[model samples]
Target: MTDASLAARAVALDLVREVLRKSVPLDDAFDAHPDLGALEPRDRGFVRLLVSTVLRRLGQIDALIEGSLAKPGLPKAVVHDVLRLGTAQLVFLGTPAHAAVDTSVELAAARGAAPYKGLINAVLRRLSREGAELAKAQDAGRLNAPDWLWLAWRQAYGTARARGIVEAHLTEAPLDVTVKENPAAWAAPLEATPLPTGTLRRPAGGAITELPGFAEGAWWVQDLAASLPAKLMGDVRGKRVYDLCAAPGGKTAQLCAMGADVVAVDRSARRLERVKENLARLHLTAELLAADVATWDAGAPADAILLDAPCTATGAIRRHPDVQRLKQPDDVAKLARAQGRLLAHAVDLLKPGGTLVYCTCSIQPEEGEAQIDRLITRDDRVERVPVTPDELDGLAELINERGEVRSLPGMLADRGGIDGFFVARLRRLP
Candidate 1:
């Protein structure tokens, strides 16, 4: 391996360590790097791939490294990160066995851990040799998830279902885009398929803006599952729609594209600016408001409201691996509480007999089913409007027993997979 490649790997490893040990987010670390600006494009991509892949399989990687070591007495943080990067290369990335082993040792040496360099070298080489055997022996369930999280998932969704969800996240997610007007005309050159709700599914690649339809503002990238709740609100043409917690506004854009008068509200000015930019590119207009939805008032009730409430976002682990690393078990409950509060506020903003589409990109039942259950029990005016099989035409695999739309990554295996999302549509009685 070249000196520059090893150096970049080291920098990325350091960043991953800070994220794992100190809870710093990956993007923040990337922005703070003093020398990251000097890296070539390929090297930068390598850095991102290494860090993100390691984060995605952190539990398994740590378990493998722990099993390989005789004493397991190394500093928790150091060994945790070293093995994470090394295992990601050897096991997940298909990097040459020698390159994965040697580069990691070189990284250890550069970090002033020359004493343990031999240990790092020997263990990784052994891993490269017996990784498959080691993995087979490891408990697939415990190896892939933190104990509490695994247990929570098991309880929420049976063991088999939880295991399947974790396995699904291991694969790369397809890039999905939302097209304005005709999907066939816009998606043909891109060689993509138009899924339900006019989302274009394509293999992930290149800068989004550099994609064929991007320059023309023909479409904007949005996951197939993430685009559904807004669509479930039915035709919004000429209707007053309130999009709470809206920013980077894919849903808000969807509302405006359907000819709705939308008040897009979000807490962050920076995020709201992104919504404004997206609306401009799509040649759509919506009222953009920067304020916390939990506190902000829409001034008057709307005909329809889309509350894409925030949760732990466990569903998007494939797209944003950092979520798996940064979010803790307790965070789920905290986020559920926030979602409940936001749902209550959003419901209050809906006019009687109006539709309220409550949704979250969360696999945990607490954040989706349980939250909705709470609402149904307490809010007498709200009634469940179960999504029908036809409404999920191309997405039958995502519809659950209770009619909530749950898009698991494994669902659209043939057409191209999607993110895990739970969407429930409801209506307030007059």
Candidate 2:
């Protein structure tokens, strides 16, 4: 095996270990990994694909690996991970059989587990030969997702829709970007298609930094669903808008670009600094505050407020497969409680007659509809401003009966699935 291939596989192995074993988020692990920066960009992408394939289809990979092994279980955690990486390549990623097996064996040896190299080789070779047929018989969607998540999906949406969400998560999401102005102007140059939601969609390939408008800061990478909560604010020109829990600020940029005086608040100073940098690059400005949204005083009420509250982020499964493994059932409740606090605080930050858009990148009801439901029932300070289909670029399908925006990954399967989001627009009582 080539040194580069082994190096890439080694990095993928470590990343998978960090995500599955230690429960670190994949993007965070990839960013923090020192060795990753040393690899060529192609190798870096390869490593990401390997790691993602493993996580996104982890259950099936494990099943195939376990079934291929001569013995019932592997001895160590790292060996399970080693086998996982090899199996992902073989069964899911469609990596060449010889390259997948040889590099994986080398990767195991590189990890000082030379004794298991033979076992890995034998298992992967067997998988390379028979894994596809084995995988076909398996319920891949159910295997890839956690039980709690699947149950939650089933409870919230029905079994069919839950299965749809799982199936969508199995595929990688395409790249979606929000542009500063004139999407039509940039679409051709970037080889992108304009979506109904006013964002540009591109294939998930190439260095994004090398894109036509990226260096010029004409657009920024954002999921179409993520960009929606900010859009729900409805003509923020000269409006005072507060973006609560804003970090790595895409919404802040959107608000600023729409002529709002934006105050972006987050608990993390480090994350706010990154947001400041992104806004600077985009030629936009916002009042950046490093303070807790639950308590930080905005001094004066806002004309519009957006509370993109934190949650399990289970909705982003397609983009960040690690969320499936990293998050726990308890995490949803914890974050839901926090989201409740932020939602209440954000509502208070809005003036009478002002609009408050509450949203989460989570499909969990407690975080989205339940929070809004409780707020309207108990607070009496705000009333739901049911989203008309027209507001969503006429994508009426995304608007729920309650007028909230609920974009499911399964809803747009033909055009490539969109991220799951729960958005509710409300108007504070006078």
Candidate 3:
């Protein structure tokens, strides 16, 4: 194998180990791994695919490994990661068996698992032969996702839909982007399909930076469901909009694109820098503040407020597969409390006649519907604005009975599913 290929594999292996054993999110690992960016573009792509594929199907890969091994337990080291990636290639990636086995053995030895090199070789070879049939015997989502999350989904979505959610998580997400203006005009030029919601959808894979209009910043990567909350604001031309917890700035960009003077607030200075970079690229401007959204005073009441509060991010597992393993039930409960606080605080930031759009990129009702319900119940000023069918491009199914939007990964499956999101539009009392 080429040196670049070997280096990429080693980095991918480290990322898998970091997520599985150390509980680090894959996105954070990618940001932290210096070698990943230094590699050739092709190798870098391979590393990402290898790491994500392994994470997406880790449960089935481990089950296949356990079946192959004569022993019961797998070590949390180089040997284990090597075997996992090897299995991923053999079964999921459709790599030639010999290539998978040889590279894995090489990687195992290089990673200081020299003692387990023979073990890695034997295990991978066996998996290459029998892994597919064995994988069929496993419940990939049930095995891969943490039990706490699995139960939460079952309780929240019911059995059939919960199963569908897990099944969707196994597949990688499509590339969906929001544009500054004229989605159709840019869609054909960019080789993208414009969705009913005005977001452009493209097949997943390829470096987003390499895509046309990226450097020019005509469009930015934002999930179809994620872009909806800003649309719920109706017309915000010249309106003051406060986007709480707006890091990475997808919705903030949307609000800015719609001619809103947006104030984006978040606690992390580092993440807010990303917002600045995106705005600069898109030639859109927003007021950015590095302060706690729950406590930071906006200096003036907003005409509209978009509170995209933090949650467990279970709905985004298709894109961030590592979330399935890293997020715990306690994480959900803790975030729900924060969501409640943020929702309450956001209400205070809105003018009496303004819109308060509460949304999360999470599917959890506790973070979405339940939080809003509580806010409207206790506060006389808050009431559901009820998203009309016309606002969502006639996709009335996405709007819940309570007039909230709950999008799952399973939605729009034929055209490649969108990310799961929950959005509720509320109005402040006059």
Candidate 4:
């Protein structure tokens, strides 16, 4: 194998280990790995694709590896990761067979799994030949998601629809961006399509940094589902808007674009810097606060508040495939408790007759519908504002009988799907 190719494989193996073994998020791992950024841009993209492919199709790849194994128990996690890497390339990515096998064996040797190098090479070679047929025979949906998540989805969405969610997650998500100005004008120049909700959907191309409007700050990378909460605020013109727990501030930028006197608050100073950078790029302004929203004083109540509370982020699994691997049931419970705290604090920061837009990139009702139910039932001052069908560009199916917006991955399957999100627009009584 070429030295350069081996280096690329090494980077991919490191990322896979960081995510699966160390429980680090893919994006965080990417950011922390100096080798990843130091590599040529093309190689960086390749490594990213390799790592993401392994994560997204891990279930199927593991099944293939297990089928090739003679013993019953699983290999060591590192060895298993190497096997997953090779199988991902062979079965899913259609990588050249020789390159896949050689690189994986090299990875095994370099990563202290040298004793199992033969096993890695043999299994991957067998997989390259027979993996497709094996994958076809297995349940793709069940194999692609973790057991707890699969059961949760089945109970919540039923059998067929839950399967569809898993299926959608296995596919790569397209790049959806929210533009600062006219969507139609940008769509034509960028070779993108305008979604019903006015977000621009572009074909997957090179690095997003190199995209046309990116440097100019004309738009920001945001999932179509994630952008909906701010849009639900409707005409924030001159309104005092607080974006709680805002980081990597896509929603905060949306609020600023609408001429809101926005105060964006979050606990991480580093992440808040990203918000400031994005706002500057777009020629927008917001009052940035690096403090916890649950305890941060807004001083005076705001006209509208967007609590994009942090949660398990299950709905975003399509985009962040590692979520299923890293986030546990306990993590969900912990996040739910935090969301409850943030929701209450958000209510305290709103004016009477003002709106509090509560949203989470989580399909779990505990973080979405159930949270709202708990809030309204316990606090009589809170009541559902009920999002109208027209506000969502006729996607009324997203709004439940109680009038909250629950967007699932399967909702826009034909258009490359969207993140799972639950948005509730609540109003405080006068």
What digit string (tens of lDDT, one per residue) describes model 1 on residues 1-430? 9988787888888889878878887888887888788888778888888888888777778778878888865664565577678888887788898888888887877777767778888778888988867777766545656677678777877877778777777766888888877887877887888777678788875667778868778888889898888878998899999998897699998888888999999898988888888888889999988888997877899999999988888889888778777888789889999999998888889999999998888888889999989999998989999998888666677888888898765566677677889999999999
**Candidate 2 at 275: error in angstroms?**
1.0
lDDT per model vs. reference: 0.83, 0.89, 0.88, 0.89
Better of 2 and 3 by TM-score: 2
Choose 2 or 4, whichever is better by TM-score: 2
Off by over 4 Å in 2: none
TM-score-better candidate, 1 vs 2: 2
lDDT of 4 at 237: 98
RMSD of 3: 1.3
- TM-score of each predicted structure versus truth: 0.93, 0.98, 0.97, 0.98
Error of 4 at 412 (Å): 1.4
lDDT of 2 by residue, 1-430 (tens): 7888898888898898888778888888999998999899999999999898888998898888878877798887878888888888888888999998888888788788899888888898899999989999999999988999999999999999999999999889999999999888989998998989889998997899999989889999999899999888989999889998898799999999999999999999999989998998899999999998999888899999988887888888999999998988889889988887888888888899999998889998888899998888889888999998788875789999999999888887777769999999999989
Q: Which sections of candidate 1 miss by over 4 Å? A: 136-142
Q: How far off is residue 324 in model 2, in Å?
A: 0.5
Give the per-residue lDDT digits (tens) of candidate 4, residues 102-185: 999988889888999988888988988998888889887789899998888899889987888898898878999999988788
lDDT of 4: 0.89
